[model samples]
Target: MAGTGTRLTLLLFSALGFWTLWGFPGKNNLLHFLGELSEPGASIPGPTYYPMKQKFTGIAPLDKQLTTLVGFFYTAVDGNRIDISLSFLNLGSQVLAAWILITTESYRAGNKGSFIITSTTLFGLSVVIVGYACVAPIWFALHLWTSKVVSNPRDWNIILEQPIKLAIAPVATLIGFGIPSAVMTLPAPSVISFDTKLNWSALQQGWPIWIYLAQKSLESIATWFQPMVSMRTEKQKRAEMVKYMRRAYLFALGTSAGAHLLYSGLGLAAYFLPGALSTKLQVQLQPENFFIPPNPFSDEKATTLPNGALWFLQWDLVIGVLATMIWGIAVRLSENGKQDDLGAWIKALVEYGVIAAAVGPSGAAVVAVWRRDERALKAKEE
Candidate 1:
């Protein structure tokens, strides 16, 4: 928190938090809905909220908000503007890459400390209570400036990590994040019961905790069956570490690129082959629709359901990516490399553009981290 990087994070993302909040359609009569979460069904059902048109299910308010917002987005897209729905697919991909990257870093040796900073359970729980947009900047800043692994990259002792921990990271990610993401998106009344979907969506909000538990549980099992974990030779350990880290980078790269390409295709179809197959809305989908942030300074409020969704999501992705890029650049700058000249930076930026064009923002971050790991391992070998 004392470093210049930490201060910069606060200055930039704190404003973003406010901008996202500007989408809070005041007078939505949400106070009662929030209050009953602790003792839901304790009293008679009250007024129904917009979009859902049903009483709150007494779940965590964040889960309820996520389910309602996503449901509204799909319904709106189904009715019209299928192109806008495409944005969610792309953004969802980017968010996934960011999540995977952060989850991986949570296990770094230097990252271990206070439960909030290093502890996986506490970190995941915090993100559950506070949205990624709120938690990520602080987390990124802590790593860039304060964490021993990032700050003292060359110190071998700072590299403390269990092989089983690395191996289980991706598995936990799949079970904890991937499955829940898919389950919550199941179509209601047609594919699954709306109430069931709501229940699952609420559960998904605590994915950070789920991922932690999954990783620990898997690690414990691996320790029992593979008791020779600590007996591996140095060469064997190094090779295995490289393999797992490479797998992580590939997973991050593939998911982000896949999502970006999927949605990008959908957006293009809106213009190129309007009414292509069963798609709705033949209106043009502009780049601004995906890249631009809503006017946060306007006198008008985002009082409608669609506008509120757009306002919140647009800022969430835009700000989230920007914060991630800053942290990536900070790490890249700190890595051991030929960074002394202007030519190197221009080449690096060019390479980043090429990767980003194909895979999206999260891919760029993953590549930066991949390169950093390569440099660190190379240094160790030397």
Candidate 2:
């Protein structure tokens, strides 16, 4: 049997290989494909035409052409719309591969299924909580900046006739704050909250429901209050606001990277380590294979589950709802506190809500379907 050292070495190498093939270059390839799909009318010159093109464009056109070509290759492989399928597959592979690597690492670290379960459960929760937390400061900063930029009397003259816009500013700012607040208050079955008797059923109960409504109402009020609050002192507000913007940017980037690394590490360890260790042991280990549903963008339904009820619930609805909430919070918080004007604030809130509504549900839907399939596959093996 291979020693633990050998197994560790293999795991490292495997992870490195996966990252190399599917991480950096893969991202570039995906970008190239997107660019091509986005701008299909762009001409693609031959390799020999590089020197002539370089003189005119100040860069080799070959590089751009190559990216588009590679993107086209992946699109052909999927046999779907070049833009959509290529983007989906690239993202799916990156996330899935990251999870596999994380899962393997977690198992090696003696965390068991803690990595997978926590990562999956908190995936939605983190987006809502962390995402919004970061956004609050950013919005505050933006509002301050805009206020400073537009403070001049000359600028105000441009909107002298637009009294309604001025009146709407503060109200809009408060609503922007409300988005994250709503998300934070929403009931989610998290690893931490799971044992607290605050499950979905409890949340749906009278007290919880009332609390939810009250919180939403409070958030709406706060949204309106945010702009008015800033009007208290322009100088103090600008300084404080700038501080928040800086802090928020740092917080969002740092926390996001940290969270991604943590989850990815856990997922990779869970999915890959067992098989690797078994291979070293020469025991022909049939490591559990998690089901990953096919891309919804594909022609097929991509539903992997056969037990209709479980499949529908697991793959179709719950996780997606969670993801939507999380993403909604993220976008809302990210854009919050950026305006002293009610109209601008309202516009920001509406924009974030729309984005979150569309993206959150769709993203969550995909994740739920994937996780459900994984659970079902594991069950079958057992």
- In order, how many clashes per candidate? 0, 42
The models' CA-based lDDT, in order, is 0.61, 0.29
Off by over 4 Å in 1: 1-11, 22-85, 114-116, 155-160, 268-279, 337-350
lDDT against true structure, model 2: 0.29
Candidate 2 lDDT by residue in tens digits, 166-285: 233223322332232233223323332321211221221122123234434654565586746534454444344334323322332232234334333433544567544333222211
* Top-TM-score structure, candidate number: 1
| lDDT (10s digit) by residue, model 1, range 90-159 | 6666876777677667666667663545665665565445544666677777666566656666535234
Question: In model 1, what is the error at residue 277, expressed in angstroms?
Answer: 7.5
**Clash total of candidate 1:** 0
What is the Cα-based lDDT of residue 257 in candidate 1?
A: 88
Worst 10 residues of 1 by lDDT: 42-51
Residue 299, model 2: Cα distance from true site in angstroms: 8.1
